[model samples]
Target: MSKIVLYWHPMSSATPIACALAELGVPHERVKVDIHAGEQRKPAYLALNPNGKVPTLTVDGAPMFEALAIHLWLAGQYGVERGLWPAEGTPERLQAMAWSTWSYVTYGAQLVRLQTARDMGTPDDPHGQAGHKAMDELLALLDQRLASQPWMLGANYSMVDLIVGSVIGYSAYIGAPVQKHPHVLAWLGKVQARPAMQIDA
Candidate 1:
């Protein structure tokens, strides 16, 4: 087995990758990067991830950063038999890719904007309000999607759910209003209930 080392922080977006690795039952080492302490800015860390983000996974010395990339790579490397990812060339695989991209590019962007507004102490500002509105629409869409399926890809909990749920969890932590979307909330609850998720938490 290739040696795997995951550099992460407890509160960072890296949470989902950690959960995915745990769920896949892959053997790996966890190295916590203290972002709050400015550890991510260190020269050595920046060499691995120029973006200076947490959850950079090194597989036998090759570095992979970004939460979504790490999840996809790990799933490809170790999760096929476990079914954490859709099989190659399957329709479900396309769905997985689409949903994961939506999670990061659409829903995640708005949530990040809201978080930025809050960090700037302007949660009620125009930018913040726009972020909130965008998030509301996205969450509603997710709720509608979940009304017909148990998970993001379908009845099974696949990599898409892990990746999407992590970003939504981050949004919730940053105070995105989740009360109006009961189905989404319920699906999140199920995702959060997983033992691997608990370990990541």
Candidate 2:
């Protein structure tokens, strides 16, 4: 077994984490739980996370549930070794960390709303409204930020983008008109274009 065991569901919220592990170039064992089949509610998985969400990283014998926390741990531990995260506690890195946190709460929640609608087989109005409201705010923020820096962390591809961008892409995937936000659209294209992220790879 690999040192890192990831519990995930394909196309679920945990997908981005798999992408991050790929970027880290570390071998990880992916144990898929069928959320669609209600396997996430099973007793076995509930022991690890009471919420029964996927993307829990079992590291050093501890289970971490939150996406940002797992991403931060991966970045803090493997990022510096691989030069992905900014130096520890530096202003630039901390700013990136702030963006990462924002992504989970703001953008991430919006995407979750979209996904919820998709899962419910509805046309996605109320959730779309929530997502659009979030997009409007975050897109503007990102546009203004990108106006100055090439990447989220001042021209470098830091863990912030990896975590946030992964969660945000669900908007576009669920038929969000992200093209309206040119900066965000461009940013998504840039991040998705990474060699590690390509589907056929």
Model 1, span 1-201: residue lDDT tens:
999999999866777777888889999899999999999999999999999989899989999898888887887777678878888899988888888889888888898789889999999899999999999999999999999999998888877887888888778878887778999899999988888888943
Q: After best superposition, candidate 1 residue 41: deviation in angstroms? A: 1.9
Which TM-score value belongs to model 1? 0.95
- Highest-scoring model, TM-score: 1
Give candidate 2 regions above 4 Å deviation: 113-127, 199-201
Lowest lDDT 10-residue stretch of candidate 1: 71-80
Candidate 2 residue-wise lDDT, 97-142, digit = tens? 7899888886767766666777788645787667666766776787
| Backbone clash count for every predicted candidate, in the order shown | 0, 0
Query: How many residue-pair clashes does candidate 1 contain?
Result: 0
